[model samples]
Target: MSTSLGRGLACSALAIAAASTAPAEVPRVATDIAPVHGLAARVMDGLGTPDLVVTPGASPHEYAMRPSEARALQEADAVFWIGAELEPWLEESIGALATDARVVELLDVEGITTLEFREGATFEGHDHEHGDDAGHDHDHDAGDHPGHEDEAEGDHAHAEDDHADGDHGSDHAEGAAHVESQGDGAHADHAVDEDHDHAGHSHEGIDPHAWLDPGNAGIWLDVIAEELSALDPENAQTYRDNAAAGREEIAAAVADVEETLSAAGGVGFVVFHDAYHYFENRFGISAAGAISLSDASDPSPARIEEVQETIRDLGVACIYSEPQFSQSLVATVSDGTEARAAVIDPLGFELETGPGFYPALIRSIGESIAGCASS
Candidate 1:
């Protein structure tokens, strides 16, 4: 409902117009992440150029703004960040910037359904292990808390219990068979517990990687168009026009991706990280599991074992890594699972030019998934 554009934003647009016609003070726009940068690039077509400071191949997990990036943010006519929670690193820098700069938090904008982190999910298992056991208390005394346990039991009955099935089968299996099956499921459960431990901690719960979903790209485009129109009323039509065109192209790319992925046979694959949930959600492609949760943290032996078990259990069709991350981790995970390692650029780690880059990026992921499937 906060419809007012930030202060000096329209003035900056005037400056851009004036700069083109007379002077040369085009409004500088800074985007926090790659998807925003891509959408903004489309909105900025034929208008003034916007400065995208975060280069391709950089992960938002730990993007420290460099001197050059800081300078770009400080000098921008409009500043765009996903949200405070998603990009904590950018917060202090954004707060330090001049008030006159139009600080637009895109997630806060109307009509955007921000992805909520899976309610009780955490990045701790993927990032690092911690002893903060206060948040995720998974224990309850069956005697003292009979009522709560009964409720939990009811809930378990309503929702299919995967563990219960495994446990039931384990009861009848012989020694080695029981041990092997139980061990595999136990390893998977431990990994799940590790992930669950950081439930309440606020560090971007739902995957902030919405750009991976091409349908979500349409949502971002609408926001960009509205923001650009507000900033430059005179040339608003151009911004809207470009955004519409961009969306159509992205939709086509999305269609191609779906077709390719559908034909790829199984949705099973492995990724360097769990950042591709939106992609999976969009195309129904199931990454067997992530090699590691964070690019910042190397996978522990136990964690690697869980990933390997998932690959084996799911009959993973391929293993894909990102150009943004080092190939070593992917190679190791692939080697352990005997899955082929292929590089997929989610953040456009490589330079992509022209207006069609958005579609090209989407199609590239589809191609990568399909190619790895056939191989």
Candidate 2:
């Protein structure tokens, strides 16, 4: 085990020791991602700490558990994560489990409604879906919520196209051959292509990365509290109290960002990716459009043209790029728009340090936009 994993385990051990006098070994709680780690840390404050699968600065999309992390998962009394969909790689490991790992997925447990990757909602999407999935309020259906279904349909179509165009075809040649032999391969391919065009071209909605919304952060904290209490009934009060405090802190931080941004008269910015719907919705700011769709994918000429047009039309003041994304992409996009470029660290991609890290994250975003707006 690396020293970090060893320290995490040791911390868990110490947390367990400080809380319990029972002969039974302390429950080892393990978390799958950094955001989950943020919630778990609060829930476990003064109780036993949980093990985090992804380190502080790793990308969640490509995370692979180390042996020590797997061991932590194996020994864990419970495991918490954002969701299987968000972390597709963890599905096999989690699904093939032998023991009762007591997984508390915040996307499921927190009762927050989920949205697809890209949505057809707004210039900067709203936060209605990201909070309080307490009822059967699933507006994910196509006509049910105006543009939502179309956006989802668009994503579905894009996925179908990617599959048909052999983006992943070489890896699944046998499947491709079977489809081709069945005479449905070409038909399937056509259907997928049509869907992709519709979705990608419609471009009528906000990107649904709701976890970026701090208001939804409240839901996650609530879910974490419930799970911690269930796991350690003895310290349920402590867990609940700690979670309440964390919730208040995060909420206050979000409010501060809102106040700051409101005072700045709603800054107009551009982003490398359309991951700002949740953030923009809360502060009533704007990100003209993304420089790209998938962070790893390159933008086509037409897409770049659209960004240039949006920048001109919206009077975009700054183009904000994330840490892992190409700064060059932002620079290229900004060249046509005549917009200045700013860098924002999303924290899931960086080693965030301090209890005020989440707060600092939100403030940093506000400050970046505010700076551009003022300039």
Candidate 1's TM-score reads 0.69
lDDT of each: 0.56, 0.55
Model 2 stretches astray by more than 4 angstroms:
1-26, 116-208, 348-355
**Worst lDDT 10-window in candidate 2:** 153-162
Off by more than 4 A, model 1: 1-26, 113-204
Candidate 2 structure quality by residue, lDDT tens digits, 1-375? 899999999999999987786633446777765555666666666555567665555544445444445555556677767665455556556554315666755554323444445542114443334333423233223221111111110000000000111122222223221112222211211112212432122232323344566655555565556665666677777766766677677767777777777777855677776666666655656565677654434667677777777788878778888875557777777786668887775544443532334555667777777777777
Q: Give each prediction's root-mean-square deviation over alpha carbons.
A: 19.6, 13.3
**CA shift of 4, model 1, Å:** 52
lDDT of 1 at 211: 64
lDDT of 2 at 197: 33
Q: What is the lDDT of residue 41 in candidate 2?
A: 67
Q: Pick the TM-score winner.
A: 2
lDDT of 1 by residue, 1-375 (tens): 233665467778998988888633335677776556767777667666555545556555445444445556656667766665555556666666524576766544433333434321112223321112212222323332111111110000000001111112322223211122222221111122334322122424445665666655665565556666666667777867776777777767777777887787775677776667666656655555677654445566777777777776666767788775568766666665657778777666563643555677777778888898888
